[model samples]
Target: MSHAPVLLAEAMTALALQPGALYVDATFGGGGYSRAMLAAGARVLAFDRDPDAIARGAVLSAEFPDRFQLIESRFSEMDRFVNEPLTGAVFDLGVSSFQFDEGARGFSFQADADLDMRMEKSGPSAAEAVNKLSEAALADLIWGYGEDDASRRIARVLVQERAHHAITRTGQLAELVERAVGGRKGARTHPATKTFQALRMLVNDELGELARGLSAAERALSPEGRLVVVSFHSLEDRLVKNFITERADARGRGSRYAPDLPPERAPSFRLEHKRATAPSDQETAGNPRARSASLRWAVRTDAPAWGELEAPALAPKAEAEWKKLI
Candidate 1:
């Protein structure tokens, strides 16, 4: 599956890019958004943690040497990379189709490949976490990240199975999960899907990165600049939604614990729209991965800059339990 930027038009429109305005594509998966920004006459500074993404960007960099910049780093470090305040920034969250389709990347369960689900292909592979983590820790990771209800039972089965034979392949882990979960019934998706998702999130610290990336984006944009984010999963969408809502409403009068922080004194971003925008039926039909995507955007206001917002704390007990499994 080649990477096609999801909601390209919607994201660009939300950004309201101005001619020659500096912009950032925080998740430059395939450089789809970066190319679009350049076409729209905006100067782009893009970041992608994946080396493949960076290498692929070479063509675009050469084509628009003066207008485009590609940085091989996570979006969490966006603030450190940009010297000037940005006119806008876009974040297309979740694993890319390119990553999933490439058999060697180990991002997909459909392909029987090595258990290496690293987004950047540098971090700990899924195989390491699955085979090394303790049962309790594995359960916590599956439940917390994947939202799998039967994580404990699945983890137990994994431990038992791996003890006899180390699980080093995607197919092996998927099979173990299916057997433990009693297999997917007719019309149901694969039973191992959630477990794979959970493991990927943990291995990459995705949620943590999103939290920090949002804050960095908010801090880095110039007043009136837009911050657009497109999320494919509820976990990612929920964080994006809450972050905007909280910041937009943070200044209002309330309890002592939440005293009225004036709007002018609040961070510069103002929620641009009320609800998230979803992909059209046409888009979903063309790209199944776009089916779950939800886009949200906000405009930076002239308010005073605020301190960095803290990333949400993961459930400690669940986190600790998952840590033990690893």
Candidate 2:
């Protein structure tokens, strides 16, 4: 299936695209957003970690040679590649429909295919972790990445199963998880849904990449430049929300010792809206994937540029609990 850019109009408006403006589409999955930007007369620099995306993007570049440049790299490295400050940036995070539909990619549990869920197809595949990692490590990854409640139990089962045969296929791993977790009757979701998600996150280091990419975008944007991010899951959305809130609040000066913490630096971006915006129900009905999507944005300010800020730690209690599972 062709990957449709979720929230296309909203994302373009969020970036406030203009003619000759340098805009970056950080996740150029299928070029829907990039095409839209090009139509708006923006100069677009787009990146995609997936080789398949890059290959397909070539066609779009051919169509708009001067206006579009497709970079075959992760968005985290965008700062290193771009010379001038960007006018705006957009990141539509999560697995694309193209990835999910391609059985060999191993992004979906429905297919009986190899456990190879690398977004870039260059990293260690899911099979490696399933067949090689220790029980504790596997459990930790599932809990930390997937937020699976029964991670330890599932890990124990995988350990036992892998001893007899390498769980090299998606079906094998999904069945193993289903057996361990006990099939939920009448539930639309599969038992292995979260397990697969966790494995993909760990194998690709998704959250880490996202944290780096967001910071890089902040540094790369020019004054009044917009940063638009559309995230499909809570973990991703939380990071976006916190980053914007902390930066906007930090721009204000106050007593450092007071219970209310002072701004660590001049805020780089002004909050665009008080709350995250979601797609209309009409959009969600047509594109089920858009159902969970949330868009949060901010506009870069004229305030002094600040260095990188430390990313917040995942909950210590959760990390501790996750360690036990691993």
The best candidate by TM-score is 1
Least well predicted 10-residue stretch by lDDT in candidate 2: 314-323
Candidate 1, 131: how far from true, in Å? Answer: 1.4
TM-score each candidate.
0.92, 0.91
Per-residue lDDT over 97-210 for candidate 2, one digit per residue giving the tens place of the 0 to 100 score: 999999989999878999999888875678887877778877877787778899999999999999999999999999999999888776678889888987887677677788
**Predicted candidate 1 versus true structure: per-residue lDDT over 1-326, tens digit per residue:** 57888999999999997889999999988889999999989999999999998999999999999999999999999989889878998999988878888988888789999999888877568888888888887887788788889999999999998889989999888898989988787726788988889888877878889998988888788888899999988889989888887777743365678755455545556875879999999999998889889999988777755656665545344455445544
- Estimate the TM-score for candidate 2: 0.91
Give the residue spans of candidate 1 off by over 4 A.
Answer: 250-267, 315-326
Error of model 2, residue 286, in angstroms:
0.9
Model 1: lDDT equals: 0.85
